[model samples]
Target: EIDKKSDIEFTLKVSYLEIYNEEILDLLCPSREKASQINIREDPKEGIKIVGLTEKTVVVALDTVSCLEQGNNCRTVASTAMNS
Candidate 1:
């Protein structure tokens, strides 16, 4: 389980069954300057595109699965029983 805490007086939670369901990728910063400095690279082959940016917001194209895979033991599977 991933837990996040902030002192900025707001709450945020992001979850995905395939990507970051089991781990936290990176902490969301209060400022874009801080978030920009973070070396969270997705894929060079896919190409990184700067969608938007600001003092409070920064958006970029990234592969969620790549980021999540960096965390420990992120593999998961579902099972079904034939007998009841």
Candidate 2:
């Protein structure tokens, strides 16, 4: 279950099962996923931009950077299944 109020977010998980002919708490766990920040800066001397990201391993750009001093800098990226 997820409950949201104002700018706060909460998540709760509950699981119940019957054991020994009686109801009991099989599992009760809660988890949360928080957003991370990524910063991207252009390096004029290197002729390429550097991106700092978290939790995400892949980045996709639709447009091309013609002003880039280096060769084509646009390409497709895929994240590993373990990271995903």
Candidate 3:
């Protein structure tokens, strides 16, 4: 098991993003604003990343599911291709 590996430790973090009409939405942080100008940048060390994205630390299985539920509740579904 991975937990049995004393040489390595793991930390789990979750970020939910929605890409609609080429704009990024921070689903984990649903209250900032519906319209945003969030940018994606490439880092040499961390590779590609989304700026100002919210990350939630998950300790248990339910924690990850809770984060999903929070983000799902805030999802925007309207007259887009998926809804049209």
**Number of clashes recorded per candidate:** 0, 0, 0
Better by TM-score, candidate 3 or 2 = 3
Pairwise lDDT winner, candidates 1 and 2: 1
> What tens-digit string does per-residue lDDT give for candidate 3 at 1-84?
877888996899998988866678888885766336467899999999887788899999999999999999877787877567
Better of 1 and 3 by TM-score: 3
Question: What lDDT does candidate 3 reach at residue 45?
Answer: 100
TM-score for each predicted model, relative to the true structure: 0.18, 0.18, 0.76
Query: Model 3, poorest ten-residue lDDT window?
Result: 30-39
lDDT of 3 at 2: 72
Q: lDDT of model 2 at residue 60? A: 30
Clash pairs for candidate 2: none
* Model 3: lDDT of residue 16: 90
RMSD of 2: 24.0
**Cα error of candidate 1 at position 17, Å:** 5.4
Model 3 segments beyond 4 Å from truth? 33-37, 81-84
Sorted by TM-score, highest first, which candidate order results?
3, 2, 1
What lDDT score is found at residue 78 in candidate 2?
44
**lDDT value for model 3:** 0.83
